[model samples]
Target: MYNDLSNEELFGPSDYSETSDSESNNEVSPCSFNEPINNISYTTFPSISGLILYENLLSHKQQNELINGIVEANYFDNPESNQAMCFGTLPSFLLNAIEIISRVPGLFPDEIQNREPLFDQACSIINLYKPGEGIASHVDLPRFEDGIVVISLLSSCVMQFKPLSVIEQGDDNNDNASYYNKFKDIQNTDEPIPIILRPGSVLALSGSSRYNWTHGIEENEIDEAGDEKIIRNIRVSVTLRKMKQDQLLLNKDDSNSFSLEVKKREH
Candidate 1:
């Protein structure tokens, strides 16, 4: 759906764009960063019900540019977690990447389009993970729309997902207590499945996989990949999400108010 020639006009020319004949040829190479990840090459993790993985979704050059762009931008510390993060609207430089990601066929549930505009107002977060740093196992809050995409850069790490039912049940009156207790019997029998997230790779969590499971990375300096122990480097994750309906309504109201103020001033 994206016209490469029109990209320059719409979002301005990005340094990561393919500009030469040689670079264009490299786009078809599996190892090249210019190559786009499509459904034919996409794979789903059988172990985790709805976890989809796209290898090399961003080329090496693109990955480097994304990392550099986020680094050059402002990032705030996350007060709720150990990992420092910043949340804001996506920058223009990153729009090209978002357009590319939006074109990935069958990336979301069919109902996603009916519920809201996908990527209309792109919201994103840049998370910085240091050596031995990782997030706890938790489900994404319901405030975000269904599909959650995370692009990994700089290092490869193992992400583990476990069914939320496996957690110990708390107060019975708690809203989610019943949901958690329903699978309590399966807790001992169920094992957390690990997925290796390499640099330039994209991980899409949706449907049951997004709500029913808790995902996290172990706080280890190194991750074991097959027989190799991959040392952890400073990694950055750029997560893209859509705001829920209520949030969208608030934004619409705020926009209308600003427009009214501007019109009054002009009159």
Candidate 2:
């Protein structure tokens, strides 16, 4: 029903580090992206944050290309977890993204120079929504967590966040179990904060959205003017972040060793 965005690099590939088996330190966590929802400010439901992207990330042509089935060879792969590293082949974009993300306040200074230059190669992720397959509105867990840089590719879609109430958000006591639970009836809630996104748009939302609120893509339809009539468009976004494993790989990223917070799941 929508268009996919694709782009060739304005900037070229980057100088990333190579690691042997035991070199876990330089390896950034490949967010397997499972457990798609979690605890947070909006208990009954996740609060709302609008869509965000950098104007310079992608050129117009690169941003509005036709999206078809992505070739499997293009992404990072983990056979065991059925995940691919979407960012692996595109070190140039990933590196540029790191420079952008480091400017955010929460991203520590040391973390940027050491880890960002090496730890994170790129992000690898894919989102598929059927006629009925859609996400309920919810906040992302662990606010202000990673040094995040996200790029959007594929079909355009609507993502929304519902308004939160005083009674809705509970105290954040830094507890794991509490945050793990999903409270609000996220499946089609109300008071939404909404935005539509296009391909080639890059969003640096981790500094804010990951913790403060909940957001989701609404079930939608598509209409094409080209050869195709209507097809449920797929969206593939690559999110780059400075996580615990990234810091560990580059010892200079932090004064202390990497803490085991929000570790990457198997991929």
Candidate 3:
């Protein structure tokens, strides 16, 4: 739960309005490219359903504040190793970030928006990555429900997404080997769709994009953004998720079959 903060504190007073004048008969607004809220623009990838990139979601000052907060927490004691911290509850330091996101109209599902606290569980994973360090392609744990939000800070990186190929576990009792091969084949393919995540950008994933695709960054010192090459830097990513009521454990059988659908670059 959060205290009542004025719209001026969340967004510039002149940029946002808290009045009901914009709402006609209490109709909810849909998050689309045509209708941008709070001077924030977004790009949606056709290749992956429910994948949205909210560009410049936070100001430079806000980004710095988050980075400083993470540093002060002493979560990154070893500068040489990649580390991650998981939170079952929302930390006081992250309230500002969550508040800023909740202020954006129509970015989340209606039911979620209607909730008083927005997210009930408010589980989060904060990852600190050094240059040339990257994570493997994998899906989030099944314990989390849909509507996963990721906010990137400090430096920009390229994240690639590829649809998973279904492999029936029938007769193949070795699930580990099956999953390893599937991920290896999917990631080794040349048809992955890459998206550049700039500083203070928010990436939302749900539906097919959330469940059917594998997203990860490559281990490279340099990443390509269109024609320009960006040198990788120390970066921090905050991934927010809501835990399911059942708190189900990871299910290897939940992998769904998906076909390739590569859409043109829209970012």
Best by TM-score: 3
Could you give candidate 3's per-residue lDDT for residues 38-120 as a string of tens digits? 44566667668877777666765676677777777666665543445343444555767777776776566677556666543
Give one digit per residue, the lDDT tens place, for model 1 in 1-267.
Answer: 112323222222222222111111123222333455443335576555667766556665667567567655534233233232223344654665676667566667777633445654435655666678876665665566778888887776778778765343222232334433343344444677767776766788888778777777888999874565667766667777776778666555423211110001000
State TM-scores per candidate: 0.68, 0.47, 0.70
User: lDDT values of the candidates?
Assistant: 0.57, 0.39, 0.61
When summed lDDT is taken over every stretch of 10 residues in candidate 1, the lowest stretch is 258-267
Per-residue alpha-carbon lDDT of candidate 2 for residues 197-245, written as tens digits (9 for 90 to 100): 4455455454335544556565557533223333335555555653355
Q: For residue 259, what is the lDDT in candidate 2?
A: 21
Model 3, residue 29: C-alpha shift (Å) = 18
What lDDT, from 0 to 1, does candidate 1 have? 0.57
- Backbone atom clashes (below 3 Å) for every candidate: 1, 17, 0
Cα misplacement distance, residue 197 of candidate 3 (Å)? 0.5
Which rank order by lDDT, best down to worst?
Answer: 3, 1, 2
